[model samples]
Target: MEYSWIRLLVLVACLFPALVECRVRHYKFNVVLKNTTKLCSSKPIVTVNGKFPGPTLYAREDDTVLVKVVNHVKYNVSVHW
Candidate 1:
C-alpha cells in the first residue's frame, strides 16, 4: 500500500506541468479618427484599427483575453464585448 501511494505521487508530479499552463491571449488595439467619405459626405469617424465596426474577438473555454486599447484620436473611446 505504501508503494502504491509513492507511485501515485510521482505520476501526479509528472503530469502537473501539462495540466497547468498560462492560457491567456493578449491583443493591442489602436483607436483613431480620420476623415472618411460616406453617403457623399465627409466627416471624422471613430474607428478601431481603422475599421468602423472594429475587429472580432475570438476565445475558447477556460481561456483569458487581455486587450489594450490606445486612443490617438480626439474622441471619447468606449469598448464593449
Candidate 2:
C-alpha cells in the first residue's frame, strides 16, 4: 500500500506541470468614460472597453493571464481580480 502511494505521488509530481502549463493569455483593458441612464439618472462612469460591468474574461485550468489596463480618463484607477 505504501509503495503504491509513493508511486502515485511520484507520477503526479512529474506529470502535473507538463499537462497544464506554458499557456499565457494577454488581455487589454481600456478604462474609459461613458454616460449611463439605464435605471435612473444619467451620470458619467468608468468602464472597461465602454461596458458597464466590464468585460468577460476566460481562462482554463493552470493558465496564466496578464491584463494591461490603460487609463483614458483623469482619475487614478485600480483593478482587482
Candidate 3:
C-alpha cells in the first residue's frame, strides 16, 4: 500500500510540468552598420534595424519570447533581455 502511494506521488510530480499552459512568441532582428553624426562624430555605428536603442520587446506572464538576430556588420554583437 505504501509503495502504491509513493508511485502515485512520483507520477503526479512528473506530470505536473506537462500540465502547465504556456505560449511562445517569436521575433526577428537584423543587425547592420550605418554612419551617423550623433555624438559630434560621423562614425559608423552598429545598430539593429537602423536604430541605436534597438526595439522594445513585449510579453506576458508564462509566455516565452524567442528572438532571431541576424548580423551584417563586421563586428560582433550580442543581444539580451
Candidate 4:
C-alpha cells in the first residue's frame, strides 16, 4: 500500500505542470510622441494588441512559450526577452 501511494505521488508530480496552465500573452502599442526637449521622439507603450491591458493567457510551467506579435504601426519594432 505504501509503495502504491508513493507511485501515485510520483505520477501526480510529473503531471502537475501539464494539468496547470501558465502560458501568457502580452501586447503593446508602439507610438512616436514628440517631446519638447528632443523636438521629436517615439516610445513604446504596453497594450494588448490595441486594447488596454491587452489579453490574458495561462499555461503550465515548463510548457513551450509560443507568441505571435503583429505590428500595425508604420515604424519598425523589436522585442527582446
Candidate 5:
C-alpha cells in the first residue's frame, strides 16, 4: 500500500513539467595579448577580446549560458571562473 502511493507520486512528478522559461545565451572570448599598463606593468598582457578585464556576461533567471573561449596567445592560459 505504501509502495503504491510512492509509485503514484513518482509518476505524477515525472509527468509534471517545469513551468519556467529557459534561454541559452552564447558568448565568445578571444584570448589575445594587448598593450596595457592597468594591471601588468611591463609588457602586453593576456586579455579577452582585447579588453583588460574581459567582458561581463549577464543573463536572466533560468538562463543557460554557453561560452566559447579561443586562445590566440602563444602561452596556455587557465582562467578561474
Candidate 6:
C-alpha cells in the first residue's frame, strides 16, 4: 500500500512538465481591399484563410513531421522548404 503511493507520486511528477510545455494560441481578424474598372488598376494582397503567417505550430526537438497544406486562395500561395 505504501509502496504503491510512492510509485504513483513519481509517475505524476515525471508527466507534469510534458503537459505544461504545450501552449495555446489565437489570431486576430483581417480584411482585404481592391479596386477595378477603367481607371487606376489597384490590387490588394490578402491573407490565406484570414491569416498572414498562418497557424501556430508546436513540437518538441527531433520530431518527425508529415503535413499537407490546402490552399483556399484563387492565386498561388508559396511556402519555402
Best by TM-score: 2
Sort the candidates on TM-score, descending order: 2, 1, 5, 3, 4, 6
TM-score of each: 0.66, 0.69, 0.64, 0.37, 0.65, 0.36
The 0-to-1 C-alpha lDDT of every candidate, in the order given, reads: 0.85, 0.88, 0.86, 0.56, 0.87, 0.54
Give each prediction's root-mean-square deviation over alpha carbons: 6.9, 4.9, 7.9, 7.1, 7.7, 8.8
Q: What is the lDDT of residue 37 in candidate 4?
A: 28
Worst 10 residues of 1 by lDDT: 15-24
lDDT per residue as tens, model 4, 1-81 = 999999999999897855666555443433332322243665555443444445555555665656667665566756555
Model 3 residue 10 CA deviation in Å? 34
- Which residue runs of candidate 4 sit more than 4 Å off their true CA positions? 1-46, 77-81
lDDT of 3 by residue, 15-75 (tens): 7975667889898899999899976879887888888879888887789999999999887
Off by over 4 Å in 2: 1-17, 20-22
Clashing residue pairs for model 3 = none
Per the 3 Å backbone cut-off, how many clashing residue pairs does candidate 6 have?
0
Q: Scored by Cα lDDT, where does model 6 land?
A: 0.54
Deviation in Å, model 6, residue 29 alpha carbon:
16
List residue ranges in candidate 3 displaced over 4 A: 1-22
Clashes of each: 0, 0, 0, 9, 0, 0
How does candidate 4 fare on TM-score? Answer: 0.37
The better-scoring model by TM-score among 1 and 2 is: 2
Error of 3 at 77 (Å): 1.3
